[model samples]
Target: MSRLWSPHIESMKREQIEEMQTELLKKQLNYVYHRAPFYQKLYKKSGVKPDDVKNINDLQKLPLTKTGDLQAEMKETGDEYSGRLCVPESELLAVYGPNQHPMPENPLITGITDSDRNTIIQHLARNLIMSGIYSGDTIQSLCWAWEPFNRVYMAANLLISPSVSEILGITPVTLEIIPLEAPRTFATARLLKPSLIIADIGHLTQLAAICQQNNISPEEIGYKTIILKEQRILSEKETKEVSEKWKAKVHNMLAVQDNMLYAEDCNIHNGLHIWEDAFIPEIVDEETGEKVGEGEAGKLAITNLFAKGNPMIRYLINITAKIEKTPCNCGRTHSRLKPQ
Candidate 1:
């Protein structure tokens, strides 16, 4: 009867979570410092060794890495990975670049080993469960697609959808969003009667309009849940409006494409819970690069605890967000991020 995917890990006490994070952080720091060329140079320049970071509290001592730094390194060195890859090339499972318009020639690329990919799938599975997805529920993913291919689709197709299908035992029906094929996609949805819909705001809005043009009620589609892949936080009014429009519960998700980090809102709608076991989230002042006061709004920084390929430590994601340490109504003890 429990909805949690990993109750023991999800319901851990705050202290227990911190203890686990400390252990993982130390291991990750040592792994990256020695293997990842980027981390080695950065730490050497900062005059801080991996052993200097004794605990989570000492994370600020590590220098912050910007996306621009990775891009510049790639451009200058002509190495696709920009020296962030810690694992050997033969061990790589997948590589992804930033999903931007006019994709940069020397874009920042992220590679993952088989272990790294599995860890990402596990985090995504946790997000799906937190967003009300359950076993036996059919998910219809309406994400973007293009000629050269979008990295978001690659994540959804190769990682997200497959995680739901295989790990969670949920049926997945992913469709590439083509303007002319809207009716056919809806027809398939109607035939399948999927219980959950996963898409971004733009695709969902388009689907709503298409349903209207066809004189179809979204409620009649019978999907009771809508998981949105959104970067910015949605307002209460906007969430309510979307839920009303689709007659489904709306859950917002924050997914960073570079490192495949994910966070999702629980039914309580408080904030997106970051998987602390896999990642360490920090909010620091953009100008000072110092930790802000508790619950204070600042740029969001993330450190990958589970990544073995490209270990991102103290990487500022340029999003203004505050971290909430209080326990949630959903009973999960992981820290929540409230993006401004």
Candidate 2:
């Protein structure tokens, strides 16, 4: 049986979801247009008024925001914010960049306001729920080196490293900085017997190989699910191999560096159901900048609805996807995307 974190919103009608998006988007556009010079310039150049975007369809008239635009802004203006700051600098609770690597001077930044932080936490909790993680389940996060994954476990107690005491007490471990090797990871898993393992596909593949070599069955380790945390799609061979080798269900989640977890696979494993309430997703043609047919593959464009401080309107995520509006058997009415 498929479990839902927020059944009401997850099963909300497509039309209703669009209605909510349109309402919030209008306010967001108006707010950014007046406060942020970056958006104001884009709006003025495109000859599109904030009020002109009345519905989701009208969003097509607006130009897509690219990473280069922000880069150029920072280079030209010497502003770390790239002119995307809707609220004052004092109001920002946190800031995020695109990767875990050490950034050069004046890198692109995504500011998080109090509202944005709250929304992110709420949505992240929901994503975990969809992944079948409950409050007491022992989770070992294997997403080593990623900084955003560290903040994703606010509700659940994430252990920095494996602890026999914590595992015996049924508490989870969140591995952020651990090395993705066999000896330490498998040793900890053998000791702690985690219920869920959060790692990308590559790490999981390595772990599975090590388990095979060490004559350790992943099922024997007591993990029920594996949440893959990177952008790449899982092949059928890899999925089956991991499922059989690890003896766990595999879920592919779609996330961005700045936005964190936005979409994830449910128990049904049809496609990654977008957190529509968090961001407005669009499948637009890369060159023409037009919306594609339903279920047709196109570039993924995201408008982070809850990002009030650093409004990302019509931002192209540089990933291709095919969106489906038809509700999945799992009960979520939000559109699903097969991101490539």
Q: lDDT scores for all predictions? A: 0.79, 0.74
Could you say which candidate leads in lDDT?
A: 1
lDDT accuracy of residue 81 in candidate 2: 86
Candidate 2 per-residue lDDT, tens place, 242-290, comes to: 7887778888767675644457778888788888887888899877778
**Candidate No. with top TM-score:** 1
lDDT of 1 by residue, 1-340 (tens): 2378888988899999999999999999999888888888889998999899889999999989888888788788788898888878888766766756678777888777767766766777777887777778887876555311223222345443444367787877777665665676678788998888777777777777778888988777777898887666667787898899888999987768676687888989898888888889999986667899987899999988888878799989868888998888898989999866
The reply for model 1, stretches above 4 Å from the true place, is 145-162, 177-181
Record all residue pairs in model 1 with backbone atoms less than 3 Å apart, i.e. clashing.
none
**TM-score list, all predictions:** 0.92, 0.88
Which ten-residue region of model 2 has the weakest summed lDDT?
Answer: 159-168
Query: Which parts of model 2 have CA positions greater than 4 angstroms off?
Result: 100-106, 144-146, 152-170, 177-183, 209-215
